[model samples]
Target: MASHSLSAVRKRRRRRAKTLLVMVGLLLLTGAGGYLALLNLEPSEAVMRERCTAVVGTETYDLNPDQASNAALIAGVALRRGLPPRAASIAIATAIQESGLRNLDYGDDAGPDSRGLFQQRPSQGWGTQAQVMDPIYAANAFYDGLLKVPGYTNMPITEAAQAVQISAFPEAYADHEPEARAFASALTGYSAASLDCMLRSAESPGDPSQVAAAAAAVFGNQSVVVNESTVTLQAVDRAGWATAQWAVANAKQLNLTSVSFGGLQWDRVGGWTSAETEPGTVTLNVAGAVVE
Candidate 1:
């Protein structure tokens, strides 16, 4: 009996150790810090935005600004790449399973090379240390692999993700499918005006150019106008929502005071209401910090 009990104890310890390794291994601070750079950006008396929500039919998913922001980027990248909506959902589901939509720089001890949002490994073909640590580059790399898989759209979300990421727990990705699909649909402009944000007022210097640049980074060929306090994205209703939601996601980071699209306005603490903008423009207003 003693011998059998000792063997069981050793087996449990090994399993625990493995779980620990994958669950919260070494913090790839460099990769994490760089990959999730946006998480640390935008310092101001800028009041943080409240929970951002994505509503699809009767289902709703509420996420923090950072998570919503990252999800927007993922969907934007997919659209920019000309991939289908299924691809975006798969990618979003994978990220949700791996990092809960927040870019992380943690990996298991046994395979400590993994880091960034996907928990990708440097040892694998993900990218160089610097590349994987950057969110744009990392997301692109993930797409690269995902695109290579044949019929990925037809596969189960978990199986599709497993094809791209040979994760130890291959089944984990399925659990996030519903939320991922909702977020992906909103961010992809498939479900127009389904994403909303509640912002708080703040006194922080803002940059229209920075928001423009970030939009361009995700959208690549999309046109954006940045002048003084206004950053406008000239798009039709659906695409405009994607741009408008992106602005809301990054509101705190950019000190955005208001985001408007198709005559729907979202200001700091103002929530969603009516606007009087042009018929085809999504505009964001950011104020210069009120110097005390």
Candidate 2:
């Protein structure tokens, strides 16, 4: 009778152990399944990129090719000239109000004294007709005067512009602040590469090489190299590409070099190459060759 009871007890312990092992295995399987599901799921807004065009006074301006390109230029200029985001926003707003991103040859009657993108007065030492008409030069000069204003960032856009221009109608500048703020938000790196431009006309001639060159002028040299079906970037900062062209133009100030795009695998050697073999692990590459 004792032997039989001991046998029964051993049988019960064995059953319990088996049950516990099965439960642990099931839990581990569930955890792994959940992890795999999360890995495969696509995030919302993954396809969205930045837009470069802005709306001003009920008019939609297509900036993708030219007007859009100016945002980077202006941002780069402002940063290089040591102006803050507030100043950049104010300048962009002033440009929107004055020229609508178009460098005009003529000014309205109210702007006879006005010229160039910001409509500076020649009499006020802003610049000569030829000099004021130059966008880069005009931008630099505007920033020079803007940097002199005390507490400009704390002031309203209208007040800030008034301090710079002292115009007869201070309220006019106020109306353009929203658009300026939006442009400034993009320029100041608040949003990551959210400001993009779509080519309005199919005939619009945009050279990626030229764009890249122009950007490199301010930002620095960036290259995409492929080796054995792998792409590699050297000394490039991917985040900086948001303002790549701007950085190229202000290269002297930013001292930036290299940006990569469109996915080449990167490794620790400051080297990026295409995956030579199937990824042993699953991978995701977002816009501009970035792996998330």
Top TM-score model: 1
In Å, residue 89's CA in model 1 sits off its true spot by: 1.2
Task: Compute each candidate's TM-score over C-alphas.
Answer: 0.79, 0.55
**Model 1, poorest ten-residue lDDT window?**
38-47
Q: Write the per-residue lDDT of candidate 1 for residues 15-105, one digit (tens) a residue.
A: 9999887766445545555544534333331344478888888998888878888888888888888888898899888888887777777
Superposed Cα deviation of residue 141, candidate 2 (Å): 0.8
Kindly provide the TM-score of model 2 when superposed on the true structure, using C-alpha atoms.
0.55
**Model 2 worst lDDT run, 10 consecutive residues:** 281-290
* Candidate 2 C-alpha lDDT tens digits along 115-209: 77777778778888888787777788878787788888898888887777767777888887776666555555553333434211111222333
Task: Tell me model 2's lDDT, rounded to 2 decimals.
Answer: 0.53
The C-alpha stretches of model 2 lying farther than 4 A from their native spots are 1-65, 110-113, 200-209, 216-241, 244-292
